[model samples]
Structure formats: structure tokens, C-alpha cells
Target: MPYVFVGSVIVGPLLGEDAVFGSLTAQLAAFAVGLPLAAITALFPLTRPMSVAAVRALCDVPGESLADGPARSRTARGRTVTWFTLHLGFGGIISGMSLALPPFAGVLIALPFAAALRGSRVGMPEVFGEGWLLALSPVIGFASLVALAGCAAGAGTLLARWAPELLGPTPADRLAAAEQRAADLAVRNRLARELHDSVGHALSAVTLQASAARRVLDKDPEFVREALTAIEETTRRTVGELDAVLGVLREGDQTAPTAPAPTLAADLDGLLKRTRAGGLRVRSAVELGPQGPDALPPMVSREAYRIVQESLSNALRHAGPDATAALRIALDGTDLEILAQNPLPATGAASRRGGGHGLRGITDRARLLGGTAEAGPVDGTWRLRVRLPLKGPHDHDHDPKKPQKPQKPQKPKESA
Candidate 1:
């Protein structure tokens, strides 16, 4: 590797007085040449990855990740250039000694045998032509080789220590990377919850609807027609929900208006009717402003709809056949209250039907909207109570009335 730099010959002339000055001058010239070469090479994006690889391999650095990616930011780009300068400058000096010292030591050792081998004093230096000095020449050469070994080892240690400090990603880059991961994970979790809720509710309703239709197949055609119609509507709704979930996966296409979200104003009546058709007797009371459920924040309306939907699905699942549930939705002062109650089943269906992934889904929707939900046995009834603020944490972001300052109306420009 010493000859790899091709600059060690600068030290090849260090023996004579004239060679001493010339060697020092050439060594300085090598360092000078390295400075500009490092700066120029660092401008290319590929240079950072290459430098990281060289440091990891040649410097004996340990770790799978030396640096995250190629340098892009100004600070990282500048660091890449500085590391290149150190490599070219110090590497040239160290490699030169590595090649020159070991060989020079060999020449000195051969000095004692020069006359015997050549039949003359042909290759022997005049200063050590005879006496103990000639014998000690090999000792001096051995000492020089040992010193070179330590110097090279020390240089390598320093490079390994500096590798991460000079080449790893900066704090700002790491922060941005973590934030990106968090946002992507949030989208995935939300989609998973949506898929779970929609599919579960549909299956429960369809099963009951089909069972009811079979019982009345030869009896009342009117009741069978109604049950089949309910099944058709339930499947259609489930397909729309699936499409919306798929659209979000396509690219977070939440604003694509082709499939609107099911809110209380738009979908609650249908939900209750379908659940009743499934054989659960639901006693309902909904009190809303003249503006109806839409008067509240869109998130509040949407989440409320889901909380009730999941509650009914849980009832169909845990309340056994023909189980009756109490449903109530009303605005209580500054908060919106939704309470659902059903008697615990005699059979150990869920150990407690009120608690499961469905219950968790209800609570998650409530908490995400800056609300609270509780479910458990109370007076022999498994009751779920949820309280949500009219203008909650999520409302600020989705509030339709939240005003935005008018743009100066310049030509279209890219936003960060």
C-alpha cells in the first residue's frame, strides 16, 4: 500500500545533503497536491460512499454501518472533503515510511556482508567500512524497522477513532429520518385499524342477516326479502370501506372524494337498522343541534360514528342471540356523550364481550380525538361510556371554520 500512493519516492533522496533539502521539498509538494485533489473529488456525490468504504476497510474500523448514506447537506459535504484531505496527506506520509524503512533496514543489514559477497567494499558506506560500527549497522536497521511499526500502528489507531466522528450522519439528519419513520408507521397503523373495524362489522351483520333469511325461507317472503336486502346493503358498504382503505394505501389519497367517510349524519341510521335486523333489539335516543351531527368537528362526528358502530358489533358478538342493547347519543354541555349498555351473556363467549380488540378500537378512536372511554361491568350490565370535547385536540387541525391567512396570490410555488 506504501507504493500505492507513488509519493514515497519523495523520501528516496534523504541520504545526501542535497538530497535532504530536495526530499523535504518533494514531501511538502505531495501534501500541497493532496489539498486540492481532496476538495475537487469531494464535490462528486459518489466520493462520500467511497471515502467511507476506504476508511472502514483500510483503517480497520469495526461496525456494519460506518456512515448512513452519501453526503448531501453542506455540512456533510464539507466533512467529506476534510476527511479526504487527511487521508491523502497523512496516508502518503505513513505509506512512504512503510515502504522505505523496511527496505532501507535490509540494505543496512546486508552492509556487513557487502565485501564478502561482492569481493570488495563496493556497496558498503565509508563511515561503517570496518570496526564495531559495521557490526552495529544491522542493529540500527532492526531498531528503525521496530520504530516504523509503532508509527504505522499509531496512525491507524487515530484514523479508526476519527472515522465515525468525521463521516457519520449529523444530528439534524438523524432527527429528520426518525420523523419520517414515525409518520409512515402512523399511516400503517391507522389503515390496519380501519380494515379490522370495517371487515368485522360487515361479517357479523351478514351472518345474522343470512341466518334470519334461512329461518323464514318458506314462511314469510316479505321478511326474507328484507333480510336479503339488508345483506346486499351491508356488503356494498363494506366494499366502499375497503376501497377507501386501498386508496389510502395507494398514496394517502384521503381527499379523493370518490368514497366519502361514514359520519354520524350520513350513516348512523343505516347502522342501527342493520344491527336491529341482525336480531339485537336496540333502544335509541339521539339528541343533536339543528345542524345535526355535522355541527361538531368532522373528526368528532366520524369517530363517534365508529365508536357506536363498534359497540353494536360487540353486542352482536357477545350479547348472544336476540340480545337487547341500550344506545344513547347526546351533547352534554361542552362534551359529547355516547353510552351503550347490554346485559352480560350467560355463556362465556369472550370472558366478557365488552373487552377485546373491538373495545380497544372504540377507546383508540375516542382518545385520538382528545376524549376518554370506559367499559366494564356496572350493575350487571356491560356498559361503555365515551366523552369527547366538541372542539378537541384533533379539531384544531380539521376544523372547517379555522381561518387561513390569504396568500399574496403569487404564481404557484412549491411548498416544503
Candidate 2:
């Protein structure tokens, strides 16, 4: 406020007629006034955050208004102009006028003293016998000063509240910001799903293979060698997939290497082999009757591979040591059906301890490809079934003799 008063004092005299003589001088004076005002007007928007910091420091209050200072919209530039005009133009004028009030009161209080000093030379009669008016001058001046302070505080508080409403972002800007945040959240969720599928499957495979190798290290050296080989291959593949996913997150580096997408027809056999080597008895069959990998889109193929991989990993981790897991893939018309079933163990604690992300990841992948998935225990066997549309919307009749579709394969739903 004092700074504002000082600016008022500095600017008030420059606007007087005596400061300018000719038209040239008048223009120069106008420029002098405009230059500082223009600078303040242009810089206030950029300096709003700094101003917030200053206000916080002065008020000793960590207000919510300060936190929202940085979110001003592109459309609030006009508000900055209005704020500058009010703060500097009217604000300075008001300060100058208020500052004049106290001095005017003092001048009024000094009038009787001047009159008495003059009356002493002319021998004029004393209007007040006890000189009460002279004594009241100090009291009046103190009252004026107190009023000034009260008004200053009130005005400052009002301006503080009013500035943010005008200078901050509009409702549209806030809506845009919310939508941007939602988009960012969706991307992060997709990345998390990818990481969970790829890394989780690899880790599950490593655990199973390591345990099998340790158990058969002396009795079956050949089996142990195969287990070690499987472990190495899984780790390397996981690292490559991790690098590919992380590469997408790198900023300003378009040349980063990315792993190519894996196809269901090519990668499914390798996935089954790894699971078999991990120690569970596995039987797999693929009947791509009409549509092959070329017929399916790349996205669908990759998601299908992940779904099978996750399903196999879950079976290896959950199904008992002697349990036989069966996997079947068949294309019926324009729909691809995938099913995996294994005998449920008497003790279900092992599956619960594995964190239960495999089925959820599979559901997310299938849903992303516009498909359906269902997984649960049915007739004493844990079953996972998914039916994805290869072409657009089309009905494909499933022959129960081939493999009973598990519970009609409900549409994929997001997990909480």
C-alpha cells in the first residue's frame, strides 16, 4: 500500500499542465506515463505467481487462492488489463486522495493557531476563552490516522479477494484441464496393464522354472538344464518388452528402439513350451479353421498372445504339481475363441497369494480389442474363456461338442 502511495505521488505531479509546455512536451509526458503503465500491464499476468508468493509471505497465510495462481487461462489476458487499470490508474488516484485527507485535517487544525498568532499583533478578542480548539488538534489528527489505517486494511482485503476471481481461469479452462488429466490417467493405466502382463508373466515363469530346476538338479540333470534355459529366455524376453514399453515414455527421443509385436500363431507355441518346461503337464490345440494370424488385426493378435501368456502363467502358478492344464484356440466364423482349463487344487491359498492380477490383465487386454472374457471355477475346474470378434459385429455359433464356451464369455469389465 505504501508503494502504491509512493507511485501515486510520483505520477500525480507528472500529469500537471506545468510539466508540459508545447505539443511535443505533452506527447512526451503522455509517453512517460504510458510506458510504466504499459510495462505493468504486460508483466502482471506473467508475474502473478510471484505476486502470489509475495502475498503469502506478507499475509502469513497459505491460502488456496495462492495455489491456483499458476492455472490462469489463456483467455484471462483481458482480466490482467482490467486489473492493471484498476490497481494503477484508479488505485493510485484513490491513494493520492486518501493521503491528502490527513494533511487537510492537519491544515484545518493549524488554522486557529495562525489566527491567534495574527490576532496577538492586532489585539483581537479571543473567540474561545480557554483555547480548547488548539488543544483538540492532536486528538483530531490521531482519529484521522486511525481511520486511514482501518480503511487501508479493508480495501486491501477486498482487492485480495477480487483479484483472483477476475485473473484466474474460466470454467472452460478448468474443464479442459480436467479432460487433459483424464487422458493422462488413461495412458498411465494402459502402460500399467502392459507392464503387469509382460513382467508378471515373466516373473511367474522364472519362479516356477527355478523351483523345478532346484528339485531335479541331481536326479534329472537334463531337465534342470532345460529349466535354466527357459528361465534365461523368459528373462531376456521380459527385458526386451520392458525396454519397448519404457521407450514410449521417453520424451524428445524418437530414435529409441522398440520390440516388434508378437503374433498369436507364432508365439503361442513358444509360450506353451515354456510352461511345459516349468513342470505342469500341458496339452494344447490350435484350430485356426478359417481366419489365421493374417486375417486378425495386429492389435488383436498381440492382445491374444498376452491373454494366453497370462492364462498359462496363472495355471503354472496356481494348478497343483500333477495337474493337467488344457489350452484350446479355434476360429469359428469371424470370431476367435480361446479357452484354458486346469484342475483346481484342494488348497486355494497359493492362487490367492499370487495377487490375482493375471485374470484382470487378460480382461483388460480383451476389452481393449472389443471382446469378452470369463474366468472362474466351473464344475471343479478353473476355466478362462474369451471370445473376440475378428471382423465387425457378427454372430458365430459355438458348437458345444468342440469345447463348451465357459458361461457365455461375458463382455470384459474394468476392475476396481
Candidate 3:
């Protein structure tokens, strides 16, 4: 609507006498050329930033686009067409009336005054003898134009105020934005969990080893040397894990190493050895059925290793100096069971029921792999047990050519 008014105002002066006194064909031709341009101006989709600037320029108010994308629905397109048509029609009417009426009224008064000067028409001399009214015609026309300009400005302001609501993001765009936010949040949460499990375990081990080394510095030289070596090894491994986690967030780093992660099934013995080196007595038994450790998927192996690592760190942190930990890994059919148990301190059942982030991490890791984990005091011993399902829902079709082998369950053999 405002566009129509502004266009008519600018084009009115250019039309001159033809706007008011031209033939019907001339008026039709003028309108035919102007209307389409008005429609294009109103219906065109501007970029969001440009639209904001235009709205502020037109109505002196801030504006936002209704749709983020260039695509618009049929209903929205229909509404825009209707608005532009009404705006152009109404503005043309107002502008034409203002321009035509003032001049027509001026001529009506001026004609009598002109006739009075010539002393030719009836009653002309009685109304105006001097031509003073003729001089005021130009002033009246100017005032009428000023009044039309003011009206158009007010209407444009109102239109700008309503623009943002009509123009802002559609429902689909909003949904896509929300989904993107959720995905980003999930990534950040997974990174936080990984960092907490990896770095926390390493720090706990280092603290225990360093404290033990310091205590035995004067009493046992050999044990002190072993503790220092374990501390150094733990620090180096922690640094590597930290690099792996951080590399995931780096962008455009083509030189970074792409190495496979170490798994619990393959590195179980090394982990147990490290725990023993930290002055804890650990007895471990690993028994893989017919499929062996290779049967376990990479993701499952990595998570399993983290659970065991955190559990061992917890045992070292909470259990007494004489605590002897037992670890059992057994694969029976399509399930892998990991059980770690340590003798609780003499401080009753309360000491056995220790709670911390390590326990929560173990539970989360197992649950994520479609497995179950239980941790608490079981018959005077602190125990952490996790059972994971090896066969996924689509595992049967994963390698259809491989023939199945009948297997028998074997008891896990204990070793010191």
C-alpha cells in the first residue's frame, strides 16, 4: 500500500496536466505501466539483512524476515499478492484524488476571477474584482500535496511495524535449527564424557604411583624405581589419549595421524600389569570362547577397556594397601562378561559402597553398548561387573557366508 502511494506521488508531478485532464486512453496507459512495477517492488523477496534495512528506512522501525530460506509456501505467496494489490490500488486513489481535486477546485475559483478582470461572465465581477483568489491557488495546491505526503508516511510506518511478524522464520526452518542445536549438544556431551574417563583415570594412577614412590624413596630403592617408571608410562599414554580426543575437534588438519584406538580385549594384560606395578596385587583370568577376542567389535572393545581402567583406578584410590583385586574376562556364546572384585577395607560396609564419577562412567559405558553393569559391595567385597551383548540386531546378515560353529561354555581359569 505504501509503495503504491509513494509511486503515485513521484509519478504525479511527471504526468503534469495529463494526470488530471488527459484522455481515458492516456490514463489507462499510465496505470498499465505503473501497476506492474509496483507489484514487482512489493512482492520481491529481499535478503534478510537488506529487508531489515528497507523496513527501517520505510517505517523507521526494526524488522526481521519471516522466512530464512528463499522458498515460500503457496499461502504466503497468495497473501503477498493480495497485500500488494490493495496497497497499490488505495495509494493510487488517494494520490489521484489529492492531485486532481485541488487543481480542479483552483480552476473553478480562478476562472471566475479571470472573467471578472475581463468583465465578461455573469456574477464574476460580484465575487472577485481584483484576482487575489487566483494568487492563492498555487499555495492551496502545495498544501494539499504536503497533506498527501504526510498521509503516505503514516501508512508506511504502520506497514513496517507489521512486517516482521509476517516475514520471520517458518515452522520448518525453526525445527531444523532446533535439531542442529541438539546434535551439537550431543557431540559436546560425548566429548566431555570421554575426557573425564581418560584424563581422570590417568591422573588417579599417576597420583597413586607418585605418592607410593615418595613414601618408599628411603626404604626401598627398587620399588621406588618401579613406581616412577609406571608414572611415566601412564603420563605418556594419557597424553596420547588426550591428543586423540582433541584431534577430533581440530579442523583442516590433514597431517594428523589416523590410528586405530587400543582395545581392552587386546590390551587387558598390559592394563593388569600396570595396576600391579602401582603396588596393587592383581590376579587376572581371560578366557575367550571359540570366537576369541577378535570376535568383539572395535567400539565394544574400546568402551570395555575404559570401564575396566576406571574401575581399577577406583579400587586403587579407595581400597586399603593390602587389597588384592581379581579380574575375570569370559566369553560365553554371544556374551562377554567382565568382573573385577577387590577386598574392602576393615571400615565396615560404608567403605565398600564408594560413589564417584568412575562408577557412573562404567555404568554409562556398559549401558551405551546395550549392556548392563552392577557395582557395589557383594558379600564383604567391592565388585564391578559388566555384561555386553556381542551380536548386534543385524549381525546375522553382516557376514552371511561364514558358517556357524557349535561351542561349549568353559569355566574361566584363575591366574596370579
**Per-residue lDDT for 1-416 in model 2, tens only?**
44433444455566664433234445344544654565454455465565456556654444554334443555565555554455454455446448566775665456466655424553333543247865665576667777777777766676666666655556765776679889888678777877877888888889988988898799999988888998999888788888766755763486766776456856766777777877777887766633444445556677788888888888877897877898887776667899988888888654342246667777777776678898887777888899887754221322225542332332332111
Question: Could you arrange the candidates by lDDT from highest to lowest?
Answer: 1, 3, 2
lDDT of 1 by residue, 1-416 (tens): 32322333443344333443245665565455446755776778888788888877787776444666788788888887887777766777787788778877887787777756323444445677656888898898899998998887887788778778778777766776788889998788777777777778989989988988999899989999999998998999889978866666766454665466688988988898888988789988776655556676778887898889888998888888767899888877778999999878886554464577788878788888778999987776788999998876775645476663332223221111
Better of 2 and 3 by TM-score: 2
TM-score of each: 0.69, 0.69, 0.66
RMSD of 3: 7.7
Give the range where candidate 3 is weakest over 10 consecutive residues by summed lDDT. 120-129
Q: What does candidate 3 score on TM? A: 0.66
Clashing pairs in 1: none
lDDT (tens digit, per residue) of candidate 3 on 1-416: 34443544555566663352344544544565567766566556643334445555665553335444432565455445544554556567676767666665555445544544435443233444446755665565566667776777766765665555544555755777689889788677667767877788778778888888898899999989889889888888778888777765653487877434557757767777777777678888778765656657667777778877877877777677867888888875577798989887787543535467677777777777788888888888888889987766425434667665655565655677
lDDT of each: 0.76, 0.66, 0.67
Number of the top-ranking candidate, with lDDT as the measure: 1
